[model samples]
Target: MAHASTAAAEDSCPLLLGKNKLPRHREADTSEGRVVERIADFQGPGGIIDLVYSAVFTRGIEKVKQECLLEAGELPLVPRNFDCWLCSTELLSLLMRGSALGNVGAHTAEGSPNTTWDGHNTIGLLSKSEKDKGVPIADALKNPLTPVWILHGGDHFTVAWCSAATPAEPGSKFLLHHWNGLPPGGPRLADLEITAIKGAISHGTSPSKFYKPEPGEIEEVVQADPDDKTDFPGQYRKWRYEVMLAFDRPDLQGEQRPVDALPEPKFQQEDPRYQRPGAWRCCLCYDRRFKTMDFSLVPADSPDWCQKCSRSRKECGWSLWIPFAELPPKRQAWCMSQYAKKIEPLLWTKWPEAEILEVSGRELPDC
Candidate 1:
């Protein structure tokens, strides 16, 4: 990942790489408005840089522009000689019709980048307009040429144009993403009278400040039996028992006490040889006397095994695992059923009894 503030410090054309880079031709190449040219001089007052950025864009809705201008009235200003930046590509998604969060990346020479679908993408680089929502309106409208519009009732603002090549096409619309400042306004943009624009904005707040109930909110304490083999003892015993009871298994019918819970797993840790990152053998599949390692170069820590053996290294001096793909259907079914049956008695102590019954494969008679 590139460090923040690097582009403007050392490069000539901060928008695009290289010296004398021409204004981007494809409107799609820019964020909100395509930044065509930028000239900065470090000779300004006390060596502070004086920068002027030239942006170009296709025309857009007058109503939207007006709304944005009105909202812009509330934003604050950037200190002199400082460049405050915003990009449309980052802000456009937030300004769409619904509160639906759209996925858009920054203005890379090659459009927004493809992203991973694993749901971890949270970093965002926004256009100056989007950031303007946090400050006063006057501060948000630093650009002189681009048009501005306001959604009348309040601080909501939208830029006049999206950019030249990627210009807001005829009938193209923007989201009220944010306001840098109250664009010479009164109520916030969310209070604007624009038709069908209500309830679309959400007041921002910190999630860490929100309240959450303590864990096991409804459980009660229960004493453990003296003969119980489970390691759990005393005061916290009931919570363990409740969890054991809540274990969902189709073949199990009654409540499972802590003892009936699955035993703490015993990992193979004693032998340094098999303890390598990818080495592991299932206790139920092999018959060797000295644990033969599966030499497939599989990561020793992988959860899957190549083969199954019927004995464990500790108990029978050998360990094995049937390759997962080759396991007989009947054996796999039997293992699943056995696992389910083992946990059956522990179902439903904390959850509603109805849920427990559904999981236990026991249909209740109609009332």
Candidate 2:
């Protein structure tokens, strides 16, 4: 009798259907009278501006508020005076099923209509949890059809997609695209190498090899800017985390090796500043001009010096040059405090076992 009652309850459930009896929820109504009507008016490829506007006006605002309360234990109240920055979860939802007209069916690991890559959320790729699952940064670059979104400094969002660089060799590079809402033009595009993207994820710094501009490039880029758009060559250096989208394709294989091993940073030991057991040295020339600048004259409070380099203060310019070991405790405390809010959370969450104490005390590990 108990078994018969259980079967009856399952049969009556609205989600169960067909001979297979698979569980499936009903799709949100996208009829003529709803938000879909407004979204339908937009034609062609819409960028982040389009995505955000459609999402907020439709239902994303309420959805994000509920999710924030459930996950973070606080409501994200939007101020009437300024625009609110949406989190990765809310942004992913807007791309996935936020609107009938703009819907790309983009799938994510943490948001509603949850989809997993290899049984884990794709967003995990940006965090320490990615050690176990999700698509590898290498494989994502190889496949041209895949789209990737990157979250930086917990505040900004950028999109990337693979495209053929030339007819001779298809899928040669990935285009780093950004949407400028202020100018009212199309998305701006830039070329990004696969190796550089991998390196940035592994090491915390943007590899200089990828972002270093060629001669005359900076001048040409400066003249073309509208002031609202970011400085082209410099923006690549600020990335913090990335997420791979699983929309329209699910069969892509994820990397099995540890996330840190994707590509060991080639330049970690090139400069002494990044090294442990830091020593006092001229900031301008590293060790090249150590004899020219006297460290003994520098005050304990203001370690920074101007016109210290006797050779040419005009040529060398004014820059604070102090070794990691010689930095005053107060300055050291200030440096640590800045990282506390944004970078510390990433360190603790992604690498729980890491010794995150000051560089003076903690031993440098192989990253």
Candidate 3:
């Protein structure tokens, strides 16, 4: 069963089949649409994004936000971004207006109920007993957006349709494992997205048509950002959650919201009031050393100052990544003391030259 227009309805768009046919449940019965029936197979480093790599939409949703592609988010495709100040709707306002990452405190507040940060639905991939609050599963799949919800489970990802599509297989709401970024059924939602973009371009559709951009248009569109509203990656650091799972749990939010998590806590901020000894030290540097940032995403060569957040270790409270292996022996010892219980063992067990960071993050999803 199928309903609603293709997110990008025209056959020129990749969301549709060869003849502009929507991905109806019956299509899975054929050879062409069977790709949607496969599963994602991911393993090891770089997470799901690594396993399902594609150059078209490189950098995952990040590139999409930083560039233009008006048709990127149409009927079946849900269009939204948190840094609207950077890019509004379909325009490519990628110029770093200010700090690369700096924004109001409640950024993650932009999290939506039924959709993942990238517009995926978790229904079929979630456990029956899972208590995570979100839009109803069955309805999420049959959205005004894409009929297919390229969902992400903990370890792996799945490309699934609504109940009307077919059997979810016993003991689960999805079908088999992901196909390792293969044709038809892709390994990650990003892969599927890029595939669609490629299909659209192959038809000779002008690239500029989809990601149209106009000078000064971004500032005009995002001018009236309401203080209380949010978009993708809202309150991300505050909530200590992944972008995919970050916003769906708005009810979990409370008074802990930082009155102003931005402005980089400069020497002028009241919260980080000037003090003799404290004022001289860089809190951002201290935090990165103590593992304040999400180490999983942090780069070994991360700079002392963050271009996104527009802050440096000089701030009262900020963080970044560490090249633990590259740090001087004394510096390495200090960082180890912070996450001692987790990585200290590496000093003893692993090879002296091993890339110890391989252990900090999540395990690969089993197929």
Candidate 4:
């Protein structure tokens, strides 16, 4: 993986590898509007990056509902009762519409229609013919100018965009972005490419439909055991579909820039405990170790008192009264070293380029 701070780290596996180095810190661009505000930074209170998915999913659902209302004059309320899962078709449709409305940005080829169904193509069931037919889509994605949205039938979505071709590898500059974390192998763009081609070769223009859950299946879906290891009650099992959305036009209105300049994550700045620039741990409780310490920053003039240690002093008979700023440099270093050791596995597993000391503990000297 490139680094955790550069792009949203949705899952444990690394997603994209850009040709250009991503900036370590960036300020939020407030002028671009709320969409930018909503997802420009990667904060981790929830441990999952779902803002992009939530935004796209909600917009797709609303678009479907609006189209239904317009065509039928009365919307069927029954379908809304179940949790909605968007098929590749619906997501592509929403992306196209969002681009047109200037809410989403995409690349498009010159002379291509202002809008075209060509933005989306689905490969069904990884058949031989399907693979052959998907060759063009796969080829188009190789160009850095092309941006495509990939949807996996197994309840996942991700995007791929090309980075500026480098001198070393000019022809293949694809980079992927996924909101959800990836499995062990990292972003599977190559796997998707192979699957797309196989699916196209096998299915060859056959009539197909993205699966939709029935209203009756909603209860079972809601009540299903998350750990059951089986497909959810209404989930589709046999078929896998991949949708590709092309970014042909350079004039599209959206956040088309590379994700280098996102604002600092909120957790680093706002988390009351464990302020940035330092790594801390509860000194009183021998067993209380912190990979990243959890404690609020007190003003420089505030009295030195370890509230956490004080709260349980009767039980542990220890009081860690040293404030963060007053800690001896040697002690501060010790804390940071401990934090680095604790986070070593994560760095090796998910964030290889992580500045271990900067991310895990503190970087500043005690006042």
Candidate 5:
């Protein structure tokens, strides 16, 4: 990632690596509006760097949500139930509507002096945007003009994070679980929205942030119980159990116990190998010992995402994921049935659209 101050502190572009080194798609190669563009110099919080890094590198939403609280201490806010980051919306769009990055790499002038990666196909996404929604108001195939948009950008990639729990229904298993009252159809472009964000740097990724892994290191780094889900970062699992316990004891909108009073996690894992930058593994998919890969080092076009997650149209992202695909068919159905249970109250108060998942949570007070 480039200097946060340089990218977000000011409006001027901070030409990154291939900013000027690569040739711009000649004006002769494009039309107007087809090369749609929106730029913002964010000035909100400084925690966005880590946030975007996680999403672009394909970190699952569950882990991103955990990091929001544990890492940033709620600085970025855990993207309320329905909302999501502008960067996530952008990357999701690229994955869903835009041409695959592999099909969109740049063409060098024969052997124009270049290093490893020159044709910059990166994208700069503000964390917040009021005007970014649209199934696909625009895409790269139509707009090949500038390699980098504005100065805000990150290594372009995709991600998904899903989970499931035991079903509540007696039968009717073997089907995927979807949000209650969720449209049987796909999400419209309008759902993504168009909004402006502050306190975010568009260029939020760098090569140094990624580290290549040694052979067999991937499997060794991923520790599975081969039973229940893997444990959270040391002490976190126990801490989370306590948090839920605290929440359940409180009455509607009542003052809960002080978080500081909560007990520290009883267990912690301290493996130096897994702590390295880009030593990322799919925490959502533990059934199979998937190979771990460095997200930052890989080319923009191809991501080593889990085949199962990819098949589920995971590009929709975490907030937007409707039916949980990570779980087995029967398991996914059971979880959805739970969400469907006792959801009558929320539909009248909230967006109602995204409130289905909350039914599985504590009873929300009517506002």
Candidate 6:
């Protein structure tokens, strides 16, 4: 009798098909119009922006949420970059601008429950948990504008969503993972070489024997960038190698709060003591790197010294554009060391023909 009843109960239970199956007694509704059954759940660090291999979305109780599988290999087809960034923005905007209440943050400074940066909840972007203090996991992924979190690794990049109140699987429309660039991925090392060759030609320099020349090739000394190419068609002659290094964390997405937990700094007034005149500053931070000028000394129309924030550029050897944005904290410091910084650009230039050396970084989800 007990065996018959057990068999009947098993038959009555919903068919087990997808990867995610909640524990018994949770009573998840799978019927249409009810809570739709999500394929999987978001499992990873809360505050860091994770590079998802794939993702999905559904509605939750009060607000929408997302369900992401950080490690799942096969995922619903979607553009890699856009999907992730959209998900991040949606969730963050809700937390920052919306009136939704919950325990996104651990506690407010006054000991009351607070969900965001003190006083201002929407001033910044996502902060990685390892770098911030007591920020909820959901906030980091919602708004990537302030943090500009990127998911880079594998074939596709992605962004994820999280909810602090419900530690369970996400179920909302906030999940997305759109791909950008080439579906096959970005330029290869050989592609960069061809770019160098083209640049050399544009500079009116004959091809040199720096890289292995063809069977019937002539050698000539010339100054040229390694990424340019003379003949666009000849670019295919060079062997291309894809250099995919680990970036960000597989289980991390974006940070929910400011790293310092302090209000973002505000400049009260221009200090006359250290006054700088006629300098073009970055629109965002107004960092003094773009172009510093002195109208008092130099003509306004004269060439101005504009320094860009190294963080914005891609890292390359001759470019010497190794910015902290591309590297982790420890590696960033180490890269800036006198020895490493001095040698890195040289290594890139002298060894243009050499294969790219793979650097190990935090492995992120494969979106």
User: Please, what is the whole-model Cα lDDT of each candidate in the order they appear?
Assistant: 0.24, 0.30, 0.25, 0.27, 0.24, 0.26
Clashes of each: 82, 0, 27, 32, 29, 51
Cα TM-score per model: 0.15, 0.31, 0.19, 0.24, 0.17, 0.21
Q: After superposition, how far is residue 340 of candidate 6 from its true place, in Å?
A: 12
Candidate 3 displacement at residue 267 in angstroms: 58
Give the clash count for model 3: 27
Name the runs in model 6 displaced over 4 angstroms: 1-85, 89-367
TM-score of 4: 0.24
Instruction: Specify the highest-TM-score model's number.
Output: 2
Query: Lowest lDDT 10-mer window, candidate 4?
Result: 193-202
Q: Whole-model lDDT for model 3 versus the true structure? A: 0.25
Superposition error at 312 for model 4 (Å): 88
Q: Write the per-residue lDDT of candidate 2 for residues 1-367, one digit (tens) a residue.
A: 1011222323445454465654421222222223345544454364445545645555546665665454333433322223654445434433433321211122233433322222222222222212212222222222222333332323333343334321212222233332222222223333322222111232122112222222111101001112212533222112121111111213434433354533321221123443222222233343234554533322334333433454332233222223323333333333333333332323322222222332233221111
- The sequence of per-residue lDDT tens digits that candidate 3 reaches over residues 165-223 is 32222222222222235333334322110111111110111111111212111101101
lDDT per residue, candidate 6, 233-316, as tens digits? 223122121111222233434343344643222221222332234422222123221354422222234223323333321221
Best by lDDT: 2
| Model 1 misplaced stretches (Cα beyond 4 Å) | 1-73, 76-123, 126-367
Model 3 C-alpha RMSD to native: 21.0
Error of 4 at 289 (Å): 63
lDDT of candidate 6 at residue 260, scale 0 to 100? 60
Model 2: how far is 148 from its true place, Å? 2.5
